[model samples]
Target: MNEAVDEAGWDVEPGDEIEPLVQAVGKLLKVCREAAGLRVAELGEVLGYGEDMIRKMERGARIPRPEYLDRADQVLNAQGHLRAFMKDVERARYPRKVRELAELEGRAVEMLLYSHHNIHGLLQTPEYARALFEMHQPAYAPSEVERGVVARAARKSVFEREPAPTLSFVQEQVTLERPHGGKMVLRRQLEYLLEVGQLRNVVLQVMPTDREEHAGVQGLIEVLKFADGTAIGRSDGAFNGRPVSSPRDLRILELRYGMIRAQALTPRESLAFIERQLGEL
Candidate 1:
């Protein structure tokens, strides 16, 4: 097994201990640069990053983008060790929003999700995730895409958690039809969906375009129910574009998501529907 996978299973809590992981990579980078006898400005010039960005990365305040890591690896002749260290840094500093979801996911007894435009993050394969990120209309640099993909993929850890929370997703049918990553990638994505859907804890429902009234037209929402039966709902634009977790607000979102699920395919039927769509593709 990979060392990273082994560490991920060790119940590594997100806290002060992460500081050392961050610092180690930063220190390694600084040492490599000094050994190369290169100034920060000189290294930045070679990497095409601002000197400040380099400084922040070396200080462990910001995640070094993959391009920076790749260049550092090549320039410092560190072989693949630096690349491995960068992955550890990412596991430490996942985006705030992704981390929030991951924490909630860890505690939730169940989850209800609605995605209108894109595949729900949990269901994405690496290639599909990359294709989705690359489509960022303005286009992301390769490093940006790698960071987003790793963060997104890492969120799937929820599926492997003990007593995994039940997941019910109401995704628009159009999302599957758009073909974001071309035929083969979409095929693999659909296959991955099938594999995940078979997990006892998951429920996936596809919202058809023919629906007369769409509950998700308002946008994406995620509702989580904890062991206490307490629930929280997060909407895309609610709370100034933050997740809405107040009991009252969560109740409202839950009601709406429930309505959306009712309007979509049933879990068993949804699986067949997705398989049929895959066949058509």
Candidate 2:
């Protein structure tokens, strides 16, 4: 038993749609180990994982990290058969909401966003994100925080798409000063905001807290527009906070978002404001 290894990190949540795939992978892993003439404990020793942990993995009760598969493939001499499951496992490890949002973001030609409490996931740096997740009320396990951080970072791929999306962000000024991950993390996040604000496809605006007329007081708002002319939007303040796709419903969210943008600092000015905040740090 490798006492030093942390093998109990990720598990397939009870109702995840990926359960069948994980089960299949788990059965395949067990088959490979048995064919190689190795017992569970023997395989665990070679993999630096515990026998109990190995049982959970073979039973489809846990999600294996990519490195685990890579090492398992080499140890079992399965010739990458085990390694082949890494991509699916990686996707399975992310929360379903993150996966769905990432898919929508991938298809979006434009994204309108307003963040009230924390830095937007797409804009958050990994360190800052990890810090924020670690502060969750129940106190997330270290594994959960890492998974969240990785999922958040993965969504930034939207920024790299060919024919980049027109991303408009309206952030509350308080998000700039909150220091969710401590001062250094906040400083890096501010610096990242400055860097991202320079992108031609992205418009980053900051809403001053002093404004008497604020439309975003309701909560976070997200609107994604697709190339096929369809759009989906959701805001905490409207429609029970459910996603709205009907033109009329989207219009309401859009109207409020337009006002929020109007009340926010201009993109160039927001960048300068962020720079000043960074300097103060």
Candidate 3:
């Protein structure tokens, strides 16, 4: 396993806590495969993965996708035991920072977002997210890109949470215009934005490119408010671009965000703006 890890050129190592869980899952997979009388190559053939990938997964050097586990469960006749680890596998697939952010999002009672660059992670479509990752400067591996797409798409689950969070987003006009994933992807993204904007609990606004009094010139801003009135916020435009949890710092962010909202188009107007962009596409 150490030799494989060294040869694979993995950029990041799994944390101590996560390593054990993945190893346990891998052990179960190996045991199930053996019980089913299937060789690693045979299992790979059945699951559409390579022999090396199957070996890596069994050795816990690779994290399996939920669908992979589901297929493995059926193939190995583990009943539901293998499938039961889907949530853990999914959580492990994401980078630690993303998981932490997702945890905060899950606890948020209200989420306020202002995006000046690209669409917010919670709002991005899978295809769009994939395209963005594909174009990353360092260039993620295909597997890593796929993992990111899935992780980002999973974050949209926040919208479906019961006792739904009050969601608000303010997107810059340029952001809508910039085709991150080509025209077709952009069109779908706009349509999706329009669709999500219609939800009663969501407020989607647009800050036009022509705005002279933009309050969010500092960049992207996000504030997640919890049930107990506590909040966490971060801004690309803020001091050193660090996250802040203090009430005073949060209030400053709130003030800027409020002003940005005021300057942006109303939700209805933003929807119409998006519609126009879709038509132009």
Candidate 4:
């Protein structure tokens, strides 16, 4: 395999302060291209991307699309490097908490999600995502909002993957009823939810506002189960509201989600519930 080194060369020196994830795939791509004795223009010719795109890929300025990555992997004869790199890039696209969640998501055979304050990130449409970002308490610059919007939008692709993981989501009734980004945007968001809920891999449940003892009262929790039967759970704690994740913590959260699912309407009934909520709009 062709190898390259950091600025310090192959010498064992100080670690990379920039974080290996920053330019990891980029460096790998550069090395892979060089090893194949292919120029940027030559590689671009095969991928139908511009040399500039290839340059950005090597510079870490852009993350390659899965299709592009797959094709490049085949063309470069790099085994599965490009495909693996895409998964890494997808994880790196989000905040540390989000990245951790995404890593867990990829390994997960099933996910249990609860959202009370807003739509679950994975379920949000672009317009809805934009609205949520724009409504940030401290406010975000347009560029920052765009970045967040894209990151959240990209997470939706998990559902499209082969052997997709099972997703079970419960949202508070009020969240669905509250309109964000006006009527048209809310309508589109609801429509997207309805359409996505029909997927065989997805199960959406709605928790009624009048539920006597809502399990989600503890807060939003996401529990992910792996094929090995190992599970991780995350929740927002007090203080800074930083996320908490651990197998033990997840067990507690999983029980709570189980209760919430029991309390809420069934998936079929929830679909009807969402339809009724949408009709109110």
Worst 10 residues of 2 by lDDT: 1-10
Cα lDDT tens digits, model 4, 20-133, are 554677788888899999998898776666776678668765555555667778999989987886665544545555555556677788988999999999999999999999
Model 3 clash pairs are none
Tell me each candidate's TM-score.
0.73, 0.96, 0.90, 0.68
Query: Where does model 4 exceed 4 Å of error?
Result: 1-94, 237-248
* Tens digit per residue, CA lDDT, model 1, 1-281: 22221112111234555666666777888888888889988986776666766676677655564556776889877777688776665556565566667777779889988999888998989999999889898998666686678878888888998977889988898887778789988888888888988999888889999989877777898888899978777777566556666777887788888899999999888889889989998
lDDT against the true structure, each candidate: 0.77, 0.90, 0.85, 0.75
Tell me the spans in candidate 3 whose CA falls farther than 4 Å from its real position: 1-12, 45-48
Please identify which of the two predictions, 2 or 4, would achieve the higher lDDT against the true structure: 2
Task: Report the Cα lDDT for residue 49, model 2.
Answer: 85
Ranking by lDDT: 2, 3, 1, 4
Which has the greatest TM-score? 2
lDDT of 1: 0.77
- Candidate 2 lDDT by residue in tens digits, 194-222: 99999999999999999999999899999
Candidate 4: give the clashing pairs: none
Write out the backbone clash pairs for model 2: none
